[model samples]
Target: MTHAPTPAAMATRKPARTAPAWDRHTWEEALLAATLPHHGARLLGWGLAHLAPTSGQFRAGTSRDAGYLGQALRLSAKQLHMGFSQLERAGLLARAGAAATDGPRHVLAQAFTLTLPSATAAARTESDG
Candidate 1:
């Protein structure tokens, strides 16, 4: 049987700190320098920046399409959904229901938009002619 790679082995190839505490110490400063609020807001900003392509009130996934975002983000669909909710509460995303299905209207999965400062600038640069 193949042995699993240990944390030390993983760190040899990837040196960046992903732990929230370490990221807060590093990226938090840079993020705060750009926008208001501190680490929590910064994490939300970063999440929004990453999720911009999917931000909107449109449908994200249907019952049959629950894994839609997983294919896009290469993350588990549940993780993607959780991240989306967090981003939404942070004002980085806006969502609503689609047209009625059978009984009452079914809520759309979600759409993505970038309202954060860094993300807004990045969106402009990419979208501009």
Candidate 2:
């Protein structure tokens, strides 16, 4: 005879997987809409799409601490800083502490919100015009 699943067994079962909250298409649209430079837009898009989202914010480490991001984006530390500045100006990103340092051990700390409604609106206006 088969035995019924115990409560402990049921509790241990993993939850069903669901689709990701954001997708490639959403990233592309946000990137296209942002008023940043090409590199800045690219960096922002990549960061939002690939980086883990913590409380709806995406954070970046110093260039030296680029980890997967630098290698994947093929951008130097200097380039990353420049992109960060551009995004900040456009109100897409916000940085904390000192700016990114060239030192290998130091990491530039930055964060940004996931939404890009302003950028999207600007893009729509440009397209409509």
Best by TM-score: 2
Candidate 1 residue lDDT tens string, 15-101: 667633222233334444442322333444454344333322233554424344345435554454555444444434455533223
Candidate 2, which segments miss by more than 4 Å at Cα? 1-28, 59-64, 96-107, 110-112, 115-129
Q: TM-scores of the models, in the given order?
A: 0.32, 0.49
Reference-based lDDT, residue 121, model 1:
44
Give the winner by lDDT: 2
**Model 1 TM:** 0.32
lDDT of each: 0.41, 0.55
Per-residue lDDT tens digits for candidate 2, residues 54-108, read 3445555524345455566776656666666555455444455555555422334
Residue-level error in angstroms, candidate 1, position 124: 26
Model 2: lowest-lDDT 10 consecutive positions: 103-112
